[model samples]
Target chain A: MALGTDYAQQDCSLARALEVVGERWSMLIVRDAFYGVRRFNDFLAHLDIPRAVLTGRLRSLVAAGVLDKEPYQQSPVRYGYGLTSAGRELWLPIYALARWGERHASDGGARTVFSHATCGTRLDIVGSCPTCCVLVAPEDVMMRPGPGALTELRQDPVSRALGRPHRLLAPIEPLSETVGEQAAEPVG
Target chain B: MALGTDYAQQDCSLARALEVVGERWSMLIVRDAFYGVRRFNDFLAHLDIPRAVLTGRLRSLVAAGVLDKEPYQQSPVRYGYGLTSAGRELWLPIYALARWGERHASDGGARTVFSHATCGTRLDIVGSCPTCCVLVAPEDVMMRPGPGALTELRQDPVSRALGRPHRLLAPIEPLSETVGEQAAEPVG
Candidate 1:
């Protein structure tokens, strides 16, 4: 979907995705929502993001269907932000990024780690196995575009690039492992 | 570790990660590297990122250990970029964000989907078992901060405010199990 500025204009799915969440304070707000912070004041206090920018981002997110503005109380003051169903699903991205930082960019001794409640051990962000606990590989996975693909992808680039009958939900290859190998490994 | 900035600065790891990756086009550059775009000219052609900004971001990322500069060819044309182990790991964040966009922000038909190659079924990005296909939960997880944590975290405002001992990386909490319920899952 096109945003107001062409700065975010790109036909790529990732670019299309970034148009909404790629701004500076956008994901941070999402992070707070995960922390169960529903109040606007709490977001401001925790993030230290400028009020105007926070207001604008919150508005944009609300407009984009990522947040819902609701009244938390009445009388003197009443209001807060809550993640819509759409907004809450962002957990993967946030966790993935945090796990990445925890592993690659971290200073070696992690101050925190993510434990898998089921497995009862800290899970590797990139490769968590529900069956056997080991790192998985790309050939181990494939992808079909979700329900959110654009017409341009179905008709143009994907069709021209891959020459397959485009089922937006069809399984394509997992390029991460193949391309990632040359790039390096454990991309968490 | 301190970057010479005041320890009182924002102590959010996501923010610090953003401080590095959140710059315009940095993630895109990493994305391009995944696509096998190595030369500066290739990055210029692919991203349309301003040369000065690209140069600066590349230099900074190199300095920060994400990218390694190597001589691909000599005789006047002597530079190319590649992912160090550090850079390769950035895929998690990019994938995470893209997944978020697909689920929350993308219009109908706007998102991409993933499937496990072994199962030939859609993969849940959050906290699913790769083998048994079981979903993981928040109480099942734990958090120990990573190496990149700010020393400021031990200081007054941040330390006191965020004084919780455990930094939990739980499976995003589930909301209602409605059709779009995945969209509302919260992570912390």
Candidate 2:
């Protein structure tokens, strides 16, 4: 089933936002970016998305100013994707939606837990720090695998690396240079 | 252009949430439900969405427990759709995404402004009541056309009725009972 990318008739701002981030795998890609999964291989490994779909989504995100591509290596012209300020502003919506899923959709507890890096207070359902009484920014939050997280999830290196607590927006270490090279070309 | 509906390999809660509401027109339908457009024709008129798409999305939502369909007219067995508790919990994410679009995507100001119904203080970007320093629930939020709202938008009855200030989750007056009957069937 073909879904149109643009909501031509709707004048709502939500419609506009959807135009940018509302594709099938787009939001999940953004979630991975927040988790500091920058390189193409990491996203591919963690998401298991088709290479062509990942390439198209990354291109669209970069064009929409949600993610910026910059060269990380000089010789082969390998680039890493990072979220722009506009993209970082999406944290609230992403967090809120994930919280909703944890409460209403997930049978077990949250698969991931977020806490205020400074106070270590777990964020509430609305992404607010109860102890600080403030909405925690993505930069100020840390994520850790929760009780509901599957113990033996994926065998991918990126999935393994994500098991430990990490601050949001900090880069996840790439598994290897060869993995990036292998992921450079989009496969059918 | 066939986008698969499920992210089977992704183990994230956000993926789970998207599995439920991440379709092309699903979030917009949820947005209309928040605006209290209960009847099928009202949604069809206001959204300008294909009747088939609306029907499919609504059915999906009901199946996901985001909406419930109940009898509104008995003679012909007509039904009206309303958001369930699980659906109402989506307000935070919806508001956050709309706010992000208004700030980064819109050229003019907001098309809609949400305020704390009690204190009449405009909600902050994160949907928090600045005056009370509390998060406002959808029930207690008031919505009105903002400065950037186009003077003359759609000519549909639902669009015209939405021009004035209305409380979220309060039903919008149906244009006509007959409109419901006309839209009862889903078109291919």
Q: Candidate 1, residues A59-95: lDDT per residue as tens digits?
A: 9889888888888668966677877777766656665
TM-score of every candidate relative to the true structure: 0.60, 0.90
- Local accuracy of candidate 2 as per-residue lDDT tens digits, A28-59: 99999999888998889889888999999999
Residue A71 alpha-carbon offset, candidate 2, angstroms: 1.1
Tens-place lDDT per residue, model 1, B1-188, is: 42211112333345556666765577777765644456786567556667997898899789878888988667886788887777866755665565565555454543334333334344456534356565433222222222323323222221221222222221111111232333422323
Structural similarity of chain A in candidate 2, as TM-score: 0.89
What DockQ does every candidate get?
A: 0.15, 0.63
Q: Give the Cα error of residue A139 in candidate 2, in Å.
A: 1.5
- Which parts of model 1 have CA positions greater than 4 angstroms off? A1-8, A116-120, A126-188, B1-8, B107-188
Clashes of each: 30, 0
Computed on C-alpha atoms, the DockQ of candidate 2 is 0.63
DockQ of 1: 0.15
The candidate maximizing TM-score is: 2
